[model samples]
Target: MALTLVTGGTGHLGRDIVDRLVRAGSRVRVLARTPGVRSNVEWAAGDLAAGAGLQDALHDVDTVIHAATFSPIARRGGIRPIDFFRSPSAVDVEGTERLLACAEKAGVRHFLHVSIVGLDEATLPYARVKLAGERLVRASALSWSIVRAMPFYYLLDRLLAGLSWLPVWPVPTTRFDPVDTSDVADHVVTCAFDGQRGVRTEIGGPEALDLVAFARQYQDARRLHRRILPIDLSETKARGMGFVASQGVRGHLTWTDWLRRNSPEA
Candidate 1:
């Protein structure tokens, strides 16, 4: 059986990836900052930014899925927390480089990189780091594929539901092509099982919808009616949200569409 190592396997996407690997009968190991209890997965405790215990996890591993990334904490103006903005260089970018180097040493056959769509020109710090992570994977000697996809539906779904407590929800000016996190995980496992390389694929939801449209769909799905207040978005905020929206063309089934179909009211 091949040994697969996944970094940040406790996260939303990482959780899916780890579960998929285990179901496929592959021996799995995961590197996590906070080590806790998980059956069947060999957990190696380490921080990506600090670059410790990476060698232990990579040793004798056959494939690796790089899925860990830092999302925005709070964006106030142009600056953000140093850990959010600058740490990508340390964790996503440098940590990936370290993994590639160790993979080469360990004779790892393939490297699957998890990246976000529209990082090409995104103003957001997370998107920039994702792009940088892709660059590192591409330049490495290890065989690699950069899998880019739309934002996770759960991320948007929960955020809207959480904010619905307010009288009026302020929708972001941008839009999205939200994809299922499970689908992305399936694709990652496909890459691993097929040993595919030199291939770049973009995945997205079934359709496109602006932030307001998505929120309305959520309201309808939950059987709750609420007024949405749309205000002008700052240039940065608009671009940040728009980047994810741009990927909608590559994917289908806008978040609202999925909610409508899945909701009990449907």
Candidate 2:
């Protein structure tokens, strides 16, 4: 079988895809800045920003799951990147453009671009670029789909865990429908081969939760005695790159049900 190329294969969601593909016995090739190979898989070391080693890696693969992202940078007085950088336009727009051009040249069969729920690339710096990346993929001659999704549950779990260091849990007003990373990965693979072209789908967890509620419930379940303080979203610390900030709170999937099934306590 022809191999599937997964960018960011070592990342949370990307790792899920790699696991699924390997379990199904499909040939998998991952592009990494540092090559670390796994059995039944191939790793090509290069940088996507510089377009290094992309061609050599894309040689036999016809489908790509583009999951690589820049870690978000936050600054005071304004979003920090604005001083020394352009928003999503730089990486989401330009970086994706580079990938698309190369993928088109390589004759890839399908391109799957992952995006988030609320922020459109044009409006939110991060959202805008992701939106641009989708636009680029849509405009390409190759088959493509934009997977717009909500925050991943594991993301929230980690955040809550980190906040445990405080005397009390600080909750932001922002709501989240944290989708399971596995669900996202499943759909990613499905889109790659199911041949549903040019479709943009929004996915989320089984239920929505405000940060305070989520924190409180999680603490109760974990049997931790931490007071939960709710704060306004605007007052919350900014999440920088690779961090999933809440853009919207809903998805096709409900986070509540997913949480019940896979709570840290469970």
Best by TM-score: 1
Candidate 2's displacement at residue 218, Å, is 2.5
Q: Candidate 2: global Cα-lDDT?
A: 0.70
lDDT of each: 0.74, 0.70
The digit string of per-residue lDDT tens for model 2 on 78-98 reads: 234363355535446776788
RMSD, each candidate, Å? 4.2, 5.2
| Model 1: per-residue Cα lDDT over 140-226, one tens digit each | 898787787777787776667667678878777565677877777887777666756864677787766667877777887797778
Specify the highest-lDDT model's number.
1
Compute each candidate's TM-score over C-alphas.
0.81, 0.78
The collision pairs in model 1 are 204-251, 205-251, 205-252, 206-252, 206-253, 207-252, 207-253, 207-254
